[model samples]
Target: MEYNPQSKQEPLDTESEDRFASEQPSEFQQPYQYQEMKQDFKHSGPGIASFVISMVTVLGYVIAFVVVGAMATSVFDQSGNLLASASEVIITIGISVLILSALNVIGVVVGIVGLALRNRRKVFGIIGTIINGVIVLLFMMLISTVFVNAGGL
Candidate 1:
């Protein structure tokens, strides 16, 4: 292709683009539909739901961590023998883990549904499913360790 000197060219607005992001929040800013990356596609609702549920599971995990931290000193005596309060830790961990696992299961189910949706973006669904699956696997490993320690190997 030959460059035609006579053809008119649109000037690039380099100054506007070079401005810092914080200095560019104006009502005149282009809406999403007008942006170059905007597409004729919608994100799946189920995918969003799954992602949200995955985030919620993190809260339960945090609670479990807090319980473990608060009770760490009592879980075992200085002699390394399991103490009476160890049972409390086990029960709390067990109950919280089960609840979190249930949430992960729900997230996975919703993510699957999102992936099956027509003409919808699958990024969130894939991400949520992978995160939830990994968490479930980690929980399984923890439970297996408990069994092993109990002489169930």
Candidate 2:
């Protein structure tokens, strides 16, 4: 028997040639594609520096809270009434620190998401950085207010 390659007609109503060409996997689909890693297209967005600064600002507030609490506790322990009555200052600082930490955590979460989804929208990373700055400023104001009030100014 003789081989007949063109004896059968291809399915109609479509571009079978294009479909067949596309269906065939090329060199790009090889397993080695995984080994050939590629970096993100946008590398200059809000990066490690912004992340570090944001974290440091958040941590500064937390450290301030601890330090202020320690000082207030020691004063109360040593003094009979005058220093102990200054508890309001410490309480305000602690609450402010807690609020700032929560906001910074939110900023970090947003930054991570922005970094992950940068392919979809490039501005998200910048937005995350802005959010972090806002968090830092809010905390700064709170701490400054405590200082002013405590100093009787």
Candidate 3:
């Protein structure tokens, strides 16, 4: 009953210690649960790679269009005569398109693999796959139009 400021406090009772221990779960007791949580929180590298490739492909396409448009605009003369032949420009554009198409194919494949893994970053994979698919479809349509115009349809 005496108020002694310097006195050591009594140790916790056995019942109180047991209750406190029971309230907080030990990390080692449920390591498997934590392992699953860690796996769930892991970042998906393939998904991010696919998204970056898709974005780069889109940017390449835009640059190609700009370059080709500039060439087409400048290659013609004031009287619509050929200031410079367009065959070389056309060939260069064709080669660039082929390279971009190959990149889009790779992006789509990587995106599919990422989606199959079912990671938290699957959205990036899904978007990349969609963009690649659209580009492929557009390329196919362009090829079909060329065939039709050439009387090979």
Candidate 4:
């Protein structure tokens, strides 16, 4: 093309192409679209459901511990065979389940805390997620043990 500076239109050459691609707006040209997303109880982040669920898990563990503690105290009352009696077995199983349940509750609490502090620190979020996973595993293990003890094995 011939030189046409006065034409008031620039040529679409390589330079213009590069400049166009490289150009960026000082701020976003379009505002960020704010959309409310539908969330499920399982998928919700550190929201009400998480808090409620964590508390529920903790409550469940506490209940189990209380029951086990009472049962353990009762076990010693029954005399005779000190090794393997129904009461002793019950106490042992109960204690084990209670411990696992407590750990699971702790994991849920950590996960909830992580979700709460996700905005402040990503590490907290990750830790919370890990804890939550651990809790789930613990719960699963607890269930499996119960089943095995119940003769489901």
Candidate 5:
């Protein structure tokens, strides 16, 4: 087409403008979709905290068990006599177990609260609750065994 310096460029035809506008997405639609996705992925802080606490408590329990087993093995001599420091080690392990058990209980409570909040992290809360329940059961079993072995049962 020849250039016409005297004439202003004509605006797009209405039909072409409408076609272009229709091809491109609406600004409002994009933000609504983005917001919906953000809401879907929203996290529950308490649920996450409960999960983390439960995991830590379970790990501590395992480490405590291993340490206690090692101490029990090492503290006895060939004559089967307990060493002077063996009781202290046992007492320390017992105290740690008690503390971890308490933490597990707290995790369970937090998980329940998280679930009750009906947040997006409910799965984590449920998992945390289940883990804490198992840990509590294990703790009770260990305590009962200790008592039975000590002739307190």
Candidate 6:
């Protein structure tokens, strides 16, 4: 019902020093099993490689698109007529797509390898796999579209 400063006395042994007296040691040392477990878990190297590859592929796509967009403007005359040299833009796009496609393929392969590592952490592996797989699928679709259009199908 009311606050009392000296209501009850705390145990003298629990006054910080005596409380930790038995718990304290001459030096800090971890348990053997704990130390072993601490060193057991690590990030998979291939997983990191896969993630980096995917990130680079994404950046490459962005840069390629931006560059192509900039150059494409020059391919169109102000009167909406296509220039005779528009083939260069096509060639640039083809090369960019091929390179990005290859990068995604590598990322997917590396991510799969990472996932196969028995003791390593799998978060990056799974994420990289998914990202790379999606990009590869998109590239496949793009290639298919090109083939279809070229064939007049």
Best-fitting candidate, measured by TM-score? 6
> Which prediction has more favorable TM-score, 1 or 6?
6
Tens-digit per-residue lDDT, 1-153, candidate 2: 244354356544368568755766787775334543235355434444446556666687768777777666655544366474576766777676676666576666656666665444445456557768688667679779989999995
Runs of candidate 5 exceeding 4 Å displacement? 1-41, 144-153
Per-residue accuracy of model 4 over 1-153 as CA lDDT, tens digit each: 344354548557898658655664446575466765433113335443344444566566667667767766545534644443456657666676666566556656656665665324344345445545666787788788978899955
TM-scores for all candidates: the values are 0.64, 0.38, 0.69, 0.34, 0.66, 0.71
Per-residue lDDT for 73 in model 1?
73
Better of 3 and 6 by TM-score: 6
lDDT tens digits, residue span 51-135, model 6: 9999999999999999999999999999998899899998998899898889899999999999999878888899899999999
lDDT of 5: 0.82
* Winner by lDDT: 6
**What's the lDDT for all of these models?**
0.82, 0.62, 0.81, 0.57, 0.82, 0.86
Best of the two (1, 5) by lDDT: 1
lDDT of 5 at 128: 88
Compute the lDDT of residue 108 as modeled in candidate 6. Answer: 98
Write the candidate numbers in order of decreasing TM-score. Answer: 6, 3, 5, 1, 2, 4
The local lDDT score (0 to 100) that residue 145 gets in candidate 2 is 93
- Which residue window of length 10 is worst by lDDT in model 4? 40-49
Model 4: what TM-score?
0.34
Lowest summed lDDT across 10 adjacent residues in model 2 is found at 31-40
Q: Any runs in candidate 4 off by more than 4 Å, and if so which?
A: 1-46, 76-131, 141-153
State the TM-score for model 2.
Answer: 0.38
Candidate 5 residue pairs in backbone clash? none
Model 6 stretches with alpha carbons more than 4 Å out: 1-40
